[model samples]
Structures are given as structure tokens and as C-alpha cells.
Target: MAVFKEIFSHCSDLVYRKIEIEGRQAYVIYLDGLIKTEDLQNHVIDEVLARKQVGQLSVEKVEEEIVTVSAVKDQSYLEDAANDILEGNAVLTIDGHNKGIVFSIPGYKTRGVSEPDSEAAIRGPREGFIESLRVNTSLVRRKIKTTNLKIESMKIGVQTQTNIGIAYIDGIVDKNVLKELKHRLDRIDIDGILETGYIEELIEDNSWSIFPQIQITERPDTAAANLLEGRVAIFVDGTPFVMILPSTFWQQFQASEDYYDRVYIAIFLRVLRLMFVAVALMLPAFYVAVTTYHQEMIPTNLLLSVAAARESIPFPAIVEAFIMELSFEALREAGVRLPKTIGQAVSILGALVIGTAAVEAGIVSAPMVIIVSLTGIASFTIPKFSLAIAIRLLRFPLMILASIFGLFGIVVGMVILLIHLCKLRSFGVPYFEPVAPLRFSELKDVFIRTPIWMQNSRPDDFVKENKKRQANDLKPSPNKNEG
Candidate 1:
């Protein structure tokens, strides 16, 4: 038992205090700041030491008469004490024995509850999930308000021992999905899990794929919504971004705000986002294709204007496009790295100066600058950063294709991407929902969000047991006479 503490050197955080309990020597050990000192003093230490009742204090009797606590149990000496201390639990040991008892008393200071920045909404609850696992789980439980919302916890990371939880509705969630999720998690053996990404990378079906099959979100509402839809939510101890399983490629384009607003507004915004997504992914490549190999495809007036813009330019259309794209990417990266006070100003000024100067100097064509700028803006329309990155990265390959074969290259690139999407799965569920399988009913929330009243059921691909969201009879509008 003592060997473990010697190995650890009783790390500074592991507080070990020696005292006597009713004339018998004893020791109290716990992680210093993790366990509440008040609880240990009043409920455990003082109570045990000041006790008047004497018959040999068996561990059970000590718990019953002295500590009188629910989680108090016997632990074996220094090794047990060390483990308990590391786990944020308190441990007690009596003199002359190689054993001790562990008491469950965990407490640590944490950040105050605040609004989620990534998934913030203009009209909804502002509260966000904090880093604490217990608090995050409680937030989910508060929203669910049902015993069927099961939360299964496990410790990962051999060195970090980070607490991770898998939550889903018991009967609604498919058992196979749950089984696979647990199996993948059990397979992870890392030194520490500092963020949800650590678990995400380990559990994903394909590590090499750039497109994420799992959806990670900071909003509890988003997590709760997914849970009710029979999806599993994974909460890591230190990360606010909880991960949702079985995420479809189409799902990345959808946002929590879609469900919060009117059907018409939601549908319009969704369509607008979808259009932007296409533009974001293919705009640069299309520019490269048409300018390099398919100039005839351009409208006559547009082609003349493009030719005029490039008349003084030294580089070809492809090189001009590449320079502008790289400049925009650099400006965007600088904006992210700079402080908030100066970031916007620097990025905006940098882009305007670089783009205008490049065009005037004939280093890049003016029309190519406009195309690159639009592509950059279009990428921002995507709600998920991961998806936006995927779009950005694919742009380069698509550009190479365009340089070689024009429109044919764009078509081939898209085919490859679509095929990959069709092949991908999120915990055994298809990654391309509705479109690939052609579930007409589920289209309500995919490309264009259907009206709330009309969306009477969850996605058909997911929760088969509880298909309906609400009864079909409830409609928001009434006849003119009734009104």
C-alpha cells in the first residue's frame, strides 16, 4: 500500500494528514482542492477523532456511528488511499493496518455557467454547458426529465483518468449503435483526454477521412434534440463540445436555429445555406475550370470583361486565382490569430489593399480576385467549422482537376466526394441521409425544413420505435370563420 505513494511521491495535490482518532493513530488523505475541507473536517475528521463510543471501531461501525455517510467504505492502506486521492475521493486509514476506507466526497471549483458561444441563438436559452462532467450531465437531465434518459459513465486515459459519459434514450436508441459506441470507447487507451476531439478521433470509423461523421456541439439544446431523436451524445469531462453519433453528411448543413424558427424562414435560410455550401465548395474550382479550359462556356459580355481584366496580367488565370485564394486564406488566418480589438480591421484592410494592388499591378486579374473573395465569404456561411474546412481543402484538389480537364474535372471531383459520403457511416447509420436513401418524409429537415406542424415525425432512418413527434391533428392556422 505504501509503495504507490512512494512511487507518486504523494504529489502536491494529494493531501496526506496524520491524526489520532479516539487515541488510535489514523490518517486522512485526499486531493487537496478537490475535496471540500469543510466536509472532511466536520463530517469526517472531527467526528471520528471526537467520538466517545469505544468498542473496536470496525470499518462498518465507524461509517455507521462516526462518519454516518452513504459513500463511506473500507480501502486498503496507502495504495487504496493513493488511488482514491487521485480520483478526487477522500480516504481514511487507522494505525497499525495495511488498509483504509475510501469516502466519496468530491468538490472542485469550476467556471460559472455561461452562454455557448459557438451555438449561440438570438432567441433561446443563453446557458451553456460548462467543463464539469457532473454539471453537464445534470443540464442534459434537466432537459430530458425522464428516467429513460440513461447516462453511462466510464474512465478513459490511463494517466488522465478522465471521466466520459455516453447518454441516450434507452428504448428509443438502437442497441447496435450503443454497443458499437461502447466498444470503440473501451478500445481507447491514451495518456489523457483533454478535449472531446481526443475521444472523437479514437472512436471514428475512418481516421483518414476529413469529413466528420459525428456531430460535435456546445449547445445543450442541440444535444437534447439529438437525444430525443434516438441519437447518442458523448460528454467528455473537460470539453464543452459534446459529440453526437450517426451524423449524416446533410446534417452538417442543418443548425439548431432551424428548429427554433418558423417553417418558411427556416426553409428559406436552409436553402440559402445549401446554395452557399455549393458555392463555397465549387466556386474557386469552377473559376479555374472556365478561365483555363472552358472560356467559351462563359457569357459573351462576362468573357469580354474577364479578358479586359486579364489584358495586363502577367500570370495565367490559374496562377492568378491561386495567388488571390492564398492571400484570402492568409488574411482569414491572421484575423483568427489576432486580438479581437484589431483583428477585423487588419483582415479587412489587408484584403482590400492586397486585392486592389494585385489587380492594378497586373499580378492577378480583377475578376479572379472577386471570385476568390466570394468563395471565402461563402465558406463562412457553413455553421460547422469542420465542414467548412472540408470544403476548403477539397477546393485545391478540385482546382488541380479544373486546370487539367475543365468541367470534366469538377464532375469527377464531385463524384468521388459523393461516393465517399455514400460509403461513410456514423456508428452504422448512413452518413448521407434522406438524399441517398430517398426518404421523402425526412426531406422536411434536410434540404428545406418543413413546417413545424408538418414535421410530425422524427427522421425515419433513426428512431423506428417512436416515429411520431406530435399528433397530425394539431395545426397552427384555422379557417376564416373560426378566426
Candidate 2:
């Protein structure tokens, strides 16, 4: 008791309950809020008090015979016992015994599993990961029941002692990628990790790059899908987002609904999203460049209208674009930070009122307003927020380039961006895979998602051993007799 008290000194929540077990003195130690009091009273205290055997009360004896809790273990050292108590497990210490019996009865309240606000789908499983690591793992396990689906657990932060789970399919996962991931994770020596974002920043291959090398998803089905595709999923305690590694550029454009919908519809949506990605990234820059430098490219009537709209405006096209883009970004961010109901209203109303006021005031042109609004809408079409953020960050630089050198500058900026993307790597896997490397077989899912039956193999870049995913020639056909 003296040593335990000294170890947890000044900790008001540390609880020590004294009990007499068959005339032997014992103490039950646990955190007050973490341990279930009712379970402690019935399972440990009542069970020990009810035991009337005349045998010696050792840690092993008490743990094996007296404790009714299903998960029980005996720890020889005080440090291990203290750690167990901190982990919400009850620790039992007897007068004569040197070891402490640990009982797993964590009862801290956690938010129930709910649909993730960030990633919502109309046709797939709505359940998303909660803050609990165990619950998240169970969700993935429910999807892939094979024994080869391995989940390796580790404690990361020194102060937080945060639980982290690395999940991957044994045979399908790349050994090199798995080894690299473990190496990076083992090298992390932070004081505390509050969320998966901390781990993401620490473990990612390129920290300087704005693009997210590791993809995060709150949906368990998304995690499971990645696991099946020979990618790794890292689950951090106390955060709903699970980090998926070896992420490619094309994967960000994909939504879970793609797999749930019809083949042609999925293909059409993928193509549409790709087209809008170009629009979101280049529309503002293109508008500024063409209106400022290349007036001949625009048809005569449209050019006249645009010139007429900007006739009263004082600022140049670039300045006008900058004003609208920055204002739109500010409003979008405000919408996110504010309350849900009011946030959407504020963003929409703010944009409409502000854009109209700016236009009527002749502070900005109507053409620039239309361009910025269209770009904002296009950005929202992206499935992954991280990718959308990357696009948003790159837009300003591209716009600046366009303002300086016109179309030539935009071209130069795009070439540089492409070079950077091509050079980037995610956990040793090429970030621009299939496209840059020119894997013709894997192109089916890049620009267009083919029928499920046609995708018979996993991405060869990630899975070296288990390349084949499904059997060949599974396409459907009507029976002759039925027809």
C-alpha cells in the first residue's frame, strides 16, 4: 500500500479498497471512474469474500479460483501492476503475496458507433469507427473473418501510452511495406498522441508535401476494403479516423458508394469526379490567365460581356480572382467551424450576399464571381478531404503563376506539380502508381471503375504474392431455359 500510494501520489482518482479474504488482508486498487463499481463489488469483492477455502491466498490462487472476471492475469512487478491499473484494470494485492492479480473490467463511457460526418454514403454500411480501439478492430474483424487478417497491437506514446493497432492481411500484404511501416512506427518517440493526425504526421514518408501520403477514413468498411487491397490500416486510440497507408493519388477520388452502385454509374461518377478535379484545380487560374493575357481565346460576344462586366471594376483580373477565392475559402472554413445548422446557412447566405454585394458595388466582376463559385462547388465533389485540401493549397500558387506568365506560367506550374507528384512515395509505394509506371493492367480502375467481375487481380504494386483477388470469368448471363 505504501509503495502503491507513493507511485500514484497526488492522484485523487486512484482508489484503494481494503478487503478481508478468508482472514487474509488484501487491497483492490483501480481508478475510480475507469473501473465498474458494480462489477468490482460483485465479481471481485463478493467472490473473494464468499470463498471459504482453507488454502493459502496467493496471487495465482486468488486469480484462478476466486475471481469471477473472465479476463484475469497476475503481474509480478509493481510497475506492470500500476500500468494495468492505469489501463482501467483492477489490481489485487495481498499481504503475504509479492504479485498483484489484474482484472480487466474497464467501464469508461464512450460514444456509440455513429455514421461519420466526414464520409457519408447512400448505399454502404453506415457505421463508422468510434474512439474505442477494440470496437474499431471488431468492426474490421466482422468484415474480414479470415484468420490471415492480422491485427498487431503496440503502445506508442510515452506519456499517453496510447494503444495503436496495425491491421493487414498476412498473405496479401506486402512484406516490404509492412516492415517499413513497423520501422517508422517503432521509431516514433513522442510524449503523447492525442489523435491519428499526430501519428500521420510522424510516420508519413514526406512531411514537407501538402498531399496526404497516408489516407484517413472513419468508415470501417473503407478500412476493410483497403486491407483487402493489400494496404495497411492504423487505428489510434481516442480518435475515429483510422489511417490507411500506401495511398495512391487515384484512391482519393474513390468513394465507398462506387463499389455499391452499378458498373456504368460508378464509371461515370469516377470520370465526372476526375473532370471536376481538373476544374477545381485549374479553373480560377485559367480564368485569370485568359482574361488578363489571352483575350483572343474567348469568343467575341462572351469577351465583350466579360469586358463590359469588368469595365467599372478597378482591380485587375488576378486581383479580382484573389479577392473572391480568399473570401470563399474564409466562408467555407467558417462554415466548418460554426454550428452545423447555422454553419451551412451562414456559408450559403454569406456567399450569396457577399458576392452579390461585391458585384453590385463593382468591387469585383460577375465573371470572377461565377468562376470562384464554380471552383468551390467542384472542390466539394472530391471524396477525400485531404486531397481537396491539397487542391486548395495548390490553387493559390497556380493562380499566382498564371497572373505572372499567363498560360505559359500555368503550364510551368502544372509541369512542376506533376513532377513533384511523380517523385513522391507513400511508404515506399509510388504515390502516382499505374499512371506514372504505366501499368496497363491496373488502368481499369484509374480513370474508370470497371465491372467488379473484370477486376480479378489486386494492385501488383502493393501485393507481390497475392495478386489474384477473385476467380476469372464471373460475369453474369441469362439462362437459355429462362429466356
Candidate 3:
């Protein structure tokens, strides 16, 4: 008890209860907000106290008859006992013994699983991951009811002692990827990791690149699908988003809805998103370049209207684009930070009022507003928020380039960006796999959402031995008539 007190000194919520168990003096320690008191009292305390009434009992008898917790373990070290208590497990210590029994009963308030606010889908399971790591892991377990699904856990963050779980299939996952993931995780020497983002930044394939090497999702089906495809998932306690390893460039545009919806519609939507990503990257740059330097790129009447609009505006075309783009981005960030009820209203109203006032005040051209609005819309089409954020970061540099050298600068930026992407790798897998390498078989799944029956192989660079995903000749067809 003294050692336990020393370890958790100045913590007011540390609770201890003394009782005689089987004629031996015993004390149980736990955190107040962690364990469910009702379960502790009814399931454990009552039975142990009853055993004391029997007068004669042994450790074997106590183990056989008393504790109701299914996941009880003996802790020999004082540090282990203290750690278990902090993890919401009640430690029962007998007098004159250097050991304690730790009960697994983690109970505390957490957000309930619901629709993911960031990764909403039109046609897929609406359930999203919550802050509870156990609940999130169970969500994936329920989806993929295979014994091969393995979830290994480790504690990171020396001060915070944050729990991290790694999920992967045993035989299907590549051994090299799993070994690399464990090595990287073991190297994380942070003092605290409050969210999965911390782990992402710490263990990603590349820290310098703006493009995210790790894939994040709040949906269990998406995580389960990734696991089935032989990717590892890292679930950080107290965060809804789970990080999947070795994410490729094409995977960012692909959403969980692609597999849930009709193949044709999913393919069409995926293609549209691909186009929108390009637009998000280049729209404002194109607008700045054309209106500023290459007015001939625009037709005569449109150019006349653009010139007339700019005649009233005091700022240059590039400055006007900058003003509107930055304002829209500000509105977006404000919308995300504010409360949901007023957030949407605030962002919408702010953008409308600002854009209208800017144009009415002759600060920006009307055409610039339309182009900026379209660019924002295109950015929204990106399925992954991380990729959308990457696009947002890249836009400023591209805009600066366009403002200097016109369309040529945009082309140069694109070329450099493409080269950077090609040079990137995520855990030995090419970041631009199935594209720059041009694997014809993998292209079917990368560019387009092939029919499920036709997708017979797993994605490249993910699974080593289990390359075959499904049997061939499963495509549906009508039988021949006997006329």
C-alpha cells in the first residue's frame, strides 16, 4: 500500500478498500472514475467477503470460488500492480505477500460509436469508431470473424502510458511489413501520445512530405477491409481515427462506400473524385495564370467580361485569388473548430458575406470568387481529410508559382510534385505503386473500382504470399436458352 501510494502520490481519485479474505487481511485499490463500482461490489467484493465468512480458505479455493472477473491475473511486481490499477483494473493485495491479483474491468465514459463526421458515406455502414480502444477493436473483430486476425498491444508514451493496439492478419500479412511496423513502433520515445495523429507523425514513412503516408479511417469496415488486404492497423487509445500502414496514393481517393455501392456508380464517383483532386490542385492557379498573363486562353467575350470585372477591382488577379482562397480556407478551419450547430452556419454566412462584401467593395474580381468557390467545392470531393489537407497545403505553393510564371509555372510545379510522389515509399511499398510502375493487373483496382467478382488478386505490395484474393470465373452471366 505504501509503495502504491508513493507511485500514485497526490492523486485524489485513488481509492482503496480493506477487507478480510479467507482470514487474510486484503485490500483492493482502484481509480474512482475507471472501474464500475456496481460490478466491483457485486461481482468481486461480495464473493470474496463471503469466502471470509467460511473461515478456512486457500488461494486455490479463492481462485475457484471467489472472483467473477474472467480476465484476472496475478501481478508479482509492485510497478505492474500500480500500472494495472491505473489501467482501470482493481488490484487485490493480501497482507504479507508481494503479489496482487489484477482484475480486468475498465469502465469509464467514452463517446458512443456513431456516424463519422469526417468520413461520411452515402451507402455503407454508418457506425464509426469511438475513443475506446477495446470497443474499436471489437468492432473490427465482429466484422472479420477469423482466428487469424491478431491484435497485439503495447504501451507507449512514458508519461501518459497510452495504450496502442496493432491489428493484422497472421498468415496473410507480409512478415517484412509487420516486422518493420513493430520496429518503428518500438522506436517511438514520446512522453505522450494523446491521439493517433501523434503516432502517425512519429512513425510514418516520410516526415518531410506533405502527403500523408499513413491512412486514417473512423469506420470499422474500412479498417477490416484493410486488414483483409494484409495491411496493419494501429489503434491509439482515446482517439476515433485508426492508422493503417503503407497507404498508397490511389488509396486516398477510394472510400469505403466504393465497395458497398454498385460497382458502376462507385467507379463513376471515383473517376469524378480523381478529376476533382486535379481541379483542387490547379483551379486557382489556372485562374490566376489565365487572367493575369494569358488572356488569349479565354474566349473573346469571356476575356472582355473578365477584363471589365478586373477594371473595377483595385488588386491584381493573383492578389484577388489569394484573398478569396485564404478567406475560404479560414472559413473551413473556423467551421471545423466551432461547435457543430453554429459551425456550418458561421462558415456559410462568413463566406457569403465576405465574398459579397469583397466584390461589392471592388477588392476582388467576380470571376475570382466563382473560381475560388469551385476550387473549395473540388477540395470537398476528396474522400480522405488527410489528403484534402495535403492538397490544401500544396495549393499555396502552386498559386505562388502561377502568379510568377503563368501556366508554365503550374506545369513545373506539377512535374516536381509528380516526381516527389514517385520517389516516395511507405514501408518498402512504392507510394505511387500500380501507377508509375504501371502494373496492368493492379490498375483495374487502383484507377477503377472493378466488379467484386472480377477482382481476383489482392492489391500489390501489401500481402506477400496470399496474393490471390478470390477465385476466377465468378462473374455473373445469363444461361443459354434451349429454344
Candidate 4:
């Protein structure tokens, strides 16, 4: 008790209750508000008081017979007991006994499982991961009930001691990729990890790249889906967002609802998102290039109208684009930081009012406003927020390149981007898989999502060990005698 007091000195929440077990002095130690007082009184105190043994109590005997708690662990060292207490478990120590009994009675308040705001879907499971690591793991376990689904837990962060779980199916996971992941995790020497983003930044293949090498999702179904594809899901203790590793460029465009909806609808939506991604990344640059240097590309009537709109505008096309883009980005950031009730309204109204005012003031042309508005809308079509941010960040550079070299500059920027993507790797798996490396078999789900029945194999790059996803000949056939 002295040692524990020394260890937890100056902590106001530390609780120590004296009790008698078979007439011997015993103490129950826990952190106040971290445990259930009712359970402690009924299970631990009541059980100990009820024991009527004539002799002194042993740690094993008391743990085996007296404690009514479902989960109990015995620790010989005070450090282990102290750590367990800090983790919301209760520790019991007797006068003469060398070991301490740790009771798993954590009652910390947490947000209930609710639909994720960021990853809302119309046709998928509404349940999402919460901040609790165990609760999140249980959600995944509920999805994948088989014994093959393995979740290996470890502690990270020396000061915070945050719990991290690496989840993957045993047979389906690639050993090399898993090895690399473990190696990276083992090498993490950070003092604290407040969110999965910390681990992501530390372990990603290329820290300098704007593209997210790891995919984050609040949806349990999305995490489960990625795990089924032989990717690993990293769960952080205090964050709802789980990190899915070896993420491909195509995976960011995929929404959980895509698998829930019909095949045709899924394919259409997938293709639409891909097209808009291109638009979001290149539209501003394309407009600048065409209006600034390649005026021949625009039709005669549209070019004349553009010329008329810009006739009153003093600034050139590139400067005009920069002004609109920066203003739009600022409005977006403001919308996100503000309260939800007014955020969306502010972003929309601000854009409309600002764009109209800027055009009427001759600060920017009407065509430029239209192009910027379309680009903003296109950026929202991207499924993953991180990928959207990458597109947003890259837009400025592409615009700069276009402003300098026109159409040639845009082409050069694209080639350079392609080269960077081709060189990027995520946990030994290609970041731009099935396209850069050109795997035809795995292309079924890349540009367009084929019917679930048709996708009989997993991506060859990630799941080399367990390539076969399902049995062959899963396509539906009409009954000959039905009509």
C-alpha cells in the first residue's frame, strides 16, 4: 500500500479501500470514477466479507473463491498492478501476500456506437466503431465470426501507453506485408500517440507524399471488407477511425455503399467518382491553360464570350484562378471549423455571394467562377476525405505549372505525378496497384466494380497466399422452365 501510494502520489483520483478477508487485513485499490462502485461493493467487498474461513487468506484462494468478478488477473509485481489500476482495473492486496489481484471492472464513460457522420451511407450497416479499442475489436469480430480472424494487440506510446490492435485473417494475410507492418510498428518509438494519424505518419512508406498511404474509415464494414481483402486494420484506443493498410489508389474512391447497391449502380457511381476525381484535379489547370495560351482549343462562340467576360477583368487567367481557388478553400475550411447548423449554409451562401460579387465587381470573370464552382463540387465526389485533401493540395501545383507552360505544363505535371505514384509503395504493396503495375485480373474492381459474383479472387498483390476469394461459376442463370 505504501509503494502504491508512492507510485500514485499526488493523484486525487486514486482510491484505496481497506477490507478484511477471513479476518486478515486487505486493501482494494482503484481509481475513482474509473470503476463501478456498485459492482465493487457487491462483487469484491461483499464476496470478501462473506468468506468465513478460519485461517489467513492466500491470493490464489481469494481470487478463485471470493471474487465474483468475471475477469480477474494475478500480478506479483507492484508495477503491473499499478499499470492495471491506471487502465481502470481494481487491484486487491493483502497484508502478507506478495501478489496482487487485478479485477477487470472498467466503467469509464464512452460515446455509444452510432452512425458515423463522415462516412454516412444509404445502403450499408449503420453501426460504426467507437473510441474504445475492445468495443471496436468486438464490432469487427461480430462481422467476421470465424476463428481465422485474428486481432493481435500491443501497447504503443511510452507515456500514454495507448493500446493498438493489428487485425487480419490468419490465412488470407500476406506474411511479408504483415511482417513489414509489424516491423514498422515495432520501430515506432514515440512518447505518445493521441490518434491513429500519429502512427500513420510514422509508419507510412513515404512521409513526404501528400497521398494517404493508409486508408482511414469510421465504418466497421469498410474495415472488415479491407481485412477480407488481406489488408490489415490498425485500431487505436481513443479514436473511432481505424487505419486500413496497404491502401491502393483505387480503394479511396470506393464507398461502403458501393458493395451494398446493385452491380450496375455501383459501376456507374464508381465511374462517376473517377471522372469527377479527374475533373477536380485538372479542371482549374485546364481552364487556365486554355484561356491563357491554348485559345484555339475553345470554340469561337465560347472563346468570344470568355473574352468579353474577361475584358472588364484586370487580372490574367492564372491570377484570377488563384484568387477564386484560395477563396473557395478558405470558405471550405471555415465551413468545416464552424458549427454544423451554419457551416453548410455558410459555405454555400458564401461561395454564391462571393462568386457573384467578384464577377460583378470584375475581380474575376464569369467563366472562371463557373470553372471554380464545378471544381469544388467535383472535389466533394471523392469518397475518402484524405484523398480529397491530396487532390486539393495538388490542385495549386498543377495550376502553377499550367500558368507557366500552358497545356504543356499541365501534361508535364501529370507525367511527374504519375511517376511519383508509380514509385510510391504502401507496406511493400504498390500504392497505384492494378493500373501502374497493370494487373488485369485485379482490374475488375479498380476502374469499375464488377458484380460481387464475378470478383472471385482477391487482389493478387496483397493476398498472394489466399488469392481465391470465392468459388468459380457464381454468376446467376435463369431457369429454363420458369416461363
Q: Write one digit per residue (lDDT tens) for candidate 3, span 1-483.
A: 888888989999999888875556878899999998888888878888776454444344455567787888888999888888888899888776666888887778888789998899888899999999999999999999989999999999998999999999998899999999999999989899999888888888789999999999999999999998989999999999999988999999999989988989998999999999999999999888888789889999988998988898878877888888889999999999999999999999999999999889999888888998989999999999899989987988998999999999999999999999999999989999989777888888776888899889887689879888778889989999999
Stretches > 4 Å off in candidate 4: 20-23, 52-56, 481-483
Q: List clashing residue pairs in candidate 3.
A: none
Find the candidate with the highest TM-score and give its number: 2
In what order do the candidates fall by lDDT, top score first? 2, 4, 3, 1
Order the candidate numbers by TM-score, best to worst.
Answer: 2, 4, 3, 1
Candidate 1: segments with Cα more than 4 A from true spot? 1-4, 52-58, 68-81, 96-99, 477-483
**Residue 376, model 2, lDDT:** 96
**How far off is residue 176 in model 4, in Å?**
1.0
For model 2, the stretches where C-alpha displacement exceeds 4 angstroms are 21-23, 52-56
Candidate 1 vs 2: which has more lDDT: 2
What is the per-residue lDDT of model 1 for residues 1-483, given as tens digits with 9 covering 90 to 100?
365467668387777678765677777777778887887888887877676554555566667777855787777655546767787888877766656788887778888889986776776778889999989999989899999999999999978888889999987887778888898888887899999888888989887899998898888888999998889999999878899987988888878888888778888888988999889889988988888888889999999998888889888767777788888988998988999899989999999999888878879887888888889889988888889988988898888888888999999999999999888878777888788877877877788887777878877667768777789977777567753
Q: TM-scores, in order shown?
A: 0.92, 0.98, 0.97, 0.97
Model 2, TM vs. native? 0.98
Please give the lDDT score at residue 358 for candidate 2: 100
- The all-Cα superposition gives candidate 2 an RMSD in Å to the true structure of 1.3
Whole-model alpha-carbon lDDT for candidate 2: 0.92
lDDT measured at residue 257 in model 2 versus the true structure, 0 to 100: 94
